[model samples]
Target: MKKLAIFLFASLLGATAQAAEYVIDTKGAHAFIQFRIKHLGYSWLYGRFDDFNGSFQYDESKPEASSINVNIDVNSLDSNHAERDKHLRGEDFLFVEKYPTATFKSTSYEPAGDGKGKLTGDLTLRGVTKPITIDVTHVGGGKDPWGGFRQGFTGSTEFKLKDFGIDYDLGPASQTVEMILDVEGIRK
Candidate 1:
């Protein structure tokens, strides 16, 4: 009888320790957003956004309650080529002068097994907002040597630029672009 009481007490303590509120530290975190599109029906041209900021609250047990917010400067588009980068920010593409930033807000989450899930959110680009779903995987979360709680995550999503009014064409350049995001957040 004493052993059973001890076991229950230990289980309660373990559950309490597992529940923690993690604050995402933006400075300690890194986010990379990359996209690839078919260029001229021959090859794919990959590009990425260089400047962006985001934050998220995550709980492994209650992932559905997690929320994410992100902001990306449209002018930060980098295609590696100078001319292409400028053109991408021009009126023909993102039109950075009018809409300087794109944003995303997560609204729902669904489990996909093995620490992975589907996050559905509203993505706003070029003044248009649409619901997009991203595939997300939890890389793991733990404490750093310096005492910071860090969490790692990866996500991927895709959409067509034309759907958001980016109708510029580069001789068969695919309108659809596949996007991938690698993100790490630290407890605030």
Candidate 2:
């Protein structure tokens, strides 16, 4: 009788549970979008976007019910140098004047076990839309002062620059670019 009573209570708790809400912290968050390719086959050069914003809806019980939305300012591209940043904003690469923002929205998510999962989404950059998959892991979750709850998540994804209409010829040294995103956002 005791075992049956415990089981009934557990089922009631599960049925009444709801997913939590997390607020994304833009100030504390970091979005590192980077890429590189062959530059005359000599060495690989890298660059990144310095500013961006986004948020996500995460429900561990329902992985497929999750989603993410992110927007990146194309003009914020920085290659650690002024000249390169200017060139990247021009018609050759991102064409910041034409398309001011790059965005991504997740279509679905699936847990791969051990707090890791796959997030597939449509990424739009420089007027080109492509499907991208990101490997994500839960960094941590907790509450801060001021009665606010937060969760941190980090994800990484890589793709060819040419596939996104970024066909700038950087010589034979760089042919493909590997992009990485080290993001930490509060769930809201």
Candidate 3:
């Protein structure tokens, strides 16, 4: 009986020490979601989504168990030009009226050397869901001055607009869009 009790307590301790989950600090400007696409095959047009929220689970001891999920507000797209932004929010592009949000949920994590990894997940945009892989680099992680633990990462991926049903053509220039994500999360 004594040995069994000890074993159960040790197992509980090990489970508690395995992984920690963190909530993305969206309200504190800890995340940035931006995209860029070629314009007329000449210049790159850049834009960002103003509002988004996400959360992640990090297991330093078992990095393979880490995962992330994010939700972006589609109507908050900004391009620094009101006209262009409005058009992007219209039916020809994002169709924010119908699909007000985009989402990504990590399905797998493959670690590379030096705090880098390949994150493959399902990205849903414009009511279409597809698998996309992003290369992610862990920036750093530690306890913040505010008495909270934090972690950050930057990732990027490129995909064709037509894959997500955004078929608007701009003279063969807007076929592909490159998305970059910088995210920071606080331990919950």
The candidate scoring highest on lDDT is 3
- Top candidate (TM-score): 3
Which stretches of candidate 3 lie above 4 Å from their native place?
Answer: 1-17
- What TM-score goes with each of the models? 0.84, 0.79, 0.91
lDDT of 3 by residue, 1-188 (tens): 99999999998788667778899888898889999999888889999999998899887767777899999999999999999999999999999999999999999999997899999999999999999999999999999999999999999999999999988777776788999999999999
Better of 1 and 2 by TM-score: 1
TM-score comparison, 2 vs 3, better candidate: 3
Whole-model Cα lDDT of every candidate shown, in order: 0.84, 0.76, 0.92
Candidate 1, 1-188: lDDT as tens digits: 99999999998787655545454444544668888888888998999988888778777886766778889987989999999899888899889999999999999888888989999999999999999999999998888998888888888988988889987776655878899888887776
Give the clash total for candidate 1: 1
Q: How far is candidate 2 from the true structure (C-alpha RMSD, Å)?
A: 5.9
Separate clash counts for every candidate: 1, 15, 0
Question: Which portions of model 2 show Cα errors greater than 4 Å?
Answer: 1-17, 29-31, 36-43
Residue 187 in candidate 2, Cα distance off native in Å: 3.7
